[model samples]
Target: MSLTQRSSGLVQRKTATVQSVGADGGVEERDDEGYTPDEEEDHDSKETRLTLMEEILLLGLKDREGYTSFWNDCISSGLRGCILIELALRGRLELEKAGMRRRSLLNRKVLLKSSNPTGDVLLDETLKHIKETEPPETVQSWIEYLSGETWNPHKQKYQLRNVRERLAKNLVEKGLCTSEKQNFLLFDMATRPLTDGGIKQKLFEKVQESVLSRWTNNPQKMDKRMLSLIYLAHASDVLENAFAPLSYDDYEVAMKRVQELLGLEFDAESLKEGANELMWAVIAAFSK
Candidate 1:
């Protein structure tokens, strides 16, 4: 395929060897991303690394334990949020037309801008649902539907089953995680634990630096992928772990900044001439 087709993202995406970190904190030549060449200047693809869903899942998983908290109910919907944002970032989806100034972000419908495959099964699965829907569902509605939290039996078919496990398998394929079986007293189940400490460390540091040293007071100026990471992390109820290792003062400061982001007027941001309305819509849905 030509470079143009490759850069179009999602549809024409195919994984290629790329960069990651080594044990020595030096540039480790590795592999990732079927979406775009890292050197390419495309704005959307430029900020992508492990896809928003993968990064958030990585953050939530315990390195030694190899699973997330059983009591936490938020990550389910949070992963759905990640899927929506991931689709938007890949240029395969967008919020419907904003004809009226009075429409709330939550009420805005999500629609397919393209029907092509995103080279990733989960994304393509969700895309297929969106494409086959009648009038299209609102962002808030889509989140519930995808999470299997909806009451409508027909819409229940829209749910993506075993999302966390499926994403874990993707991580296993990437070599960042190792699949193993663990007993939980009731029964033995398969788990994917971090096999590479370096990769998770680098991801942790990136999340740390986003709010610590490299913080752009303006979300628009921040790397869109990282910005999405912060919000998704929060929605997943795992943002605390990212800040847990910080100094007391730094923790307080980081959380204060996070609150600022949480309180943002998503509608105002969505109304911008070229804003990512789908992203803002997902954020708005999670905020409630």
Candidate 2:
């Protein structure tokens, strides 16, 4: 085949490859887009590592727990900070592996999805305000649900609604989640999984281009904290159920939520999830 034909053939082949895989663990015609079990497993592994890193950072954040409470709190704390830290650490480690100087790395902060320059301070303030402003049950229920302390076979109705309302309210006050249409779209998006296009080569190329451009930017402008947040956005974008092409507004809100949730400002372009098949191939690595 000519080089052009070869390239074309490769793209076609990849597209077909993605199309063959289905959500049910059986090879069938692609109708609904989703991940297979293998992909899901890989995603979990990656997320597990990321979660570990997040826990480490959160531990660092509070200067708490020498050893035992670390693991327990990681499990209990919504696996929250770990995801952002994991992405930042990964970026840092990647830069180091590429021979970037240690000092340069130290000066740069990894921006995770939910980072605040003064994370502990923000949490302290948010908590204090919560204590003063909201009803005690509202705060307690949010804490309980987030800690995995609440369980209902039918989905803890009161806890879910109450926590959502309280957090939404708190976030609104903090200018984190406003009552705008954009915020509402983002809130809806957060609950849904990404699944726009199946893992085809064409989609992969677009995503990969987007990822590389975002990731390899000037570190001076885009710090590690923001990079981590971008990374979570990228990962969130790749989930089969979550992968709709986001409008700039959607992207902005998503990024903001990640920062609010993870406590960091992030670049929207960096840290994207790649093609459907590649995503599937790496699912075990990304999921917690």
Candidate 3:
């Protein structure tokens, strides 16, 4: 299945590659099947796409409550991890080379491959922070920095504020959710509840398909984005939300398969050509 098809609900976008960063700092699209001048226009006519961060957030959110578990502290870090992988997949971010000494994944620094805007506010904001930072940060550091969990005052500046709220707003804008004011006794805060169950159901179907019908035991063979989603959702401690509705037999089988994926060697996968080392690094960071 195509990348957009796997994640898409109402509309699907054709496969395209980012061949260059235009002078204006936006990505220049080149279709994988070769350039079709109208292809760009065609792709844009489709509905807005959800980023990996949004998908995972949607998975975690309660359809009616419009909020995740109060005790799920891991999600903050997990969402940060998703942002990094999302940026990498969009051809906007990457990891520094291993170099002659062959450095470890965590030891390598995160670099901006292109300053091209992702068109998502949260992504654009994070990209700007990465572009402005003097010394590059490692994947682990970036996660902590973006999560605002770092102790260093200067590093704390890199945090992406209101991440959950922002992602929810993005969903709201796309018509998948609706924002409402919810009171919590002390204060009333904005909450985004799922509006379009059709799209959200599509997300559930894609995730289930990944581990069931489309199960590729080898991480190398799996779609990088989907593979990352499974790991990231698990890391966020919200993966069970997706599988919770499964039958007893399917749930057991699906979880068993995911555990197998988690046990694979990250270092080895990172070495493969075209592999997103930054993604592996995020998985590794979360593992610890």
Among all candidates shown, the one with the greatest lDDT: 3
User: Could you tell me the TM-score of candidate 2?
Assistant: 0.23
In model 2, which range of ten residues has the least summed lDDT? 1-10
Q: Over 4 Å off in model 2, which ranges?
A: 1-79, 82-122, 125-146, 149-166, 174-212, 217-222, 234-243, 246-288
Candidate 1: where are CA atoms >4 Å away? Answer: 1-48
Regarding TM-score, does 1 or 3 come out ahead? 3
Give me the displacement of residue 5 in model 3, in angstroms. Answer: 17
lDDT of each: 0.75, 0.27, 0.77
For each predicted model, how many residue pairs clash, with residues at least 3 apart or on different chains?
Answer: 0, 45, 0
Off by over 4 Å in 3: 1-47
- Cα lDDT of model 3 overall? 0.77
Cα-based TM-score, every candidate? 0.84, 0.23, 0.86
lDDT of 2 by residue, 189-280 (tens): 12211121122222323322333334343432433323332333333322111223455564454444333423322222123332211111
- Point out the worst 10-residue segment of candidate 1 by lDDT: 1-10
TM-score of 3: 0.86
Task: Show the lowest summed lDDT stretch of 10 residues, model 3.
Answer: 1-10
Model 2 whole-model lDDT (C-alpha atoms): 0.27
After best superposition, candidate 2 residue 92: deviation in angstroms?
19
* Per-residue accuracy of model 1 over 70-97 as CA lDDT, tens digit each: 8878888999999998888766899888
1 against 2, candidate with superior TM-score: 1
